[model samples]
Target: MKVSFTYDKKQVLQALRYHFLSRKEIRLMIILVNVFALGSAFLFYFKKILPLAFLVGSFLWFILMLSFWFFLPGMVYRRATTFKDHFIMTFDPDSFSVGNERGSRSYPWKAVSNFLETPHFFHLYFDSRSFFLVPKDSFSNSDEIYQMRHMLKEKIKN
Candidate 1:
């Protein structure tokens, strides 16, 4: 199967956010920050801690959420030239290829460590920090998307 696609800014940002949140470390960090914030609030309400403690916790929580939701994605999007170009992607039984104006590259199934399905894209990961984003809208329909998902599942073990 094959498809052609160009990234939309909003969709790309959403995908980026999805990608980050999917990571174990990011999720842990968010949970930890929220826990601390809640703890601080609890203590403050019980008059067991000074107001400064609660204020600091709330500030940290807000900054962490803002960074994840906006700052990080914006910085990544701006620095990435990949999303700015059009791409032609072809998937075979054993491998896939991605082609753009600059060039084309092909990789075997082993090249992909895993894949993640977000609302708008298939986040194909080479590793935790590197990935290719294939927009779901590029597929002809739901059938193609299903086929791709099945193929990825069979090809990538983890």
Candidate 2:
């Protein structure tokens, strides 16, 4: 139940984009943010809101968005860099140990609040800012994949 694999940039980017937003969701979010900003601008135009405060608020929001964009690379880079150094894996149904690494930490499936199955990995979520990404290459065949998926889903539900 153990295998070693690497994620190339293409796979990583695809996985992140797919999980972060669907095309429709991205469009909706953009529309909502613009509408809100326009409404705020209209209020400022009519002197319904303080000009300085409105300007400051908009600037802050822009800054926050930029900050998020800037920090995201660091997050992705850190994850990619230390991905090998840190132990990354999930439990194996057959062994009842880490499917990706043994003699490491043994965590019951219930400990994870949920799991995200990306194309390349099983993202086991312990909490915000913490997770283990177990690559799909761990299983050699379709049956193993089926078993592992079933076991994980069954365990994660509780």
Candidate 3:
């Protein structure tokens, strides 16, 4: 099957956030920060910690969330020219190919280590840190999306 599409900024940004949060390290950090913030709040309420300590913890949590939710994704979207291009992608049992006016590249099923499905995109992950987003809206219908999803499950183990 084949589909052609361009990335929507809003959807792409959300997908990026999904990708970032899905990482083990990032999730761990977020959890740790949340624990700290909660602990700080409790301590402040009991007068065990100074107001300054609670404020610092709150500020740190806020900045971390802000960076992941906005700065990181926006920076990546702007820096990577791939998201701005129109693409045609083809999927088959043996391999998949993606191309634009500039050029095309084909890869065997083994190239993708795993895949993740979000509400708006399929993230084809080459490794822990790299991936390509295929917009779900580009598919002609729900059946095509289902076919693509099944094909991906068969070809890649996640």
- Which number leads on TM-score? 3
Which regions of candidate 3 fall more than 4 Å away from where they truly are?
Answer: none
- Deviation (Å) of 123 in candidate 3: 0.3
Poorest lDDT segment (10 consecutive residues) of candidate 2: 94-103
The clash count of every prediction, one per candidate, is 0, 0, 0
What TM-score does each of the candidates earn?
0.98, 0.56, 0.99
What Cα-based lDDT does every candidate model obtain? 0.96, 0.61, 0.96
Error (Å) of candidate 1 at residue 25 is: 1.2
Model 1 per-residue lDDT tens digits across residues 1-158: 99999999999999999988988999999999999999999999999999999999999999999999999999999999998999999999889999999999999989999889898999999988999999999999999999989999999988
> Stretches of candidate 2 above 4 Å error?
17-31, 34-74, 85-90, 94-103
RMSD of 1: 0.7
TM-score of 1: 0.98
| Residue 6 lDDT in candidate 3 | 95
Instruction: List model 3 lDDT by residue over 62-125, tens digit each.
Output: 9999999999999999999999999999988899999999999999999999999999999999
True-structure RMSD, every candidate: 0.7, 5.9, 0.5
lDDT of 2 at 69: 48
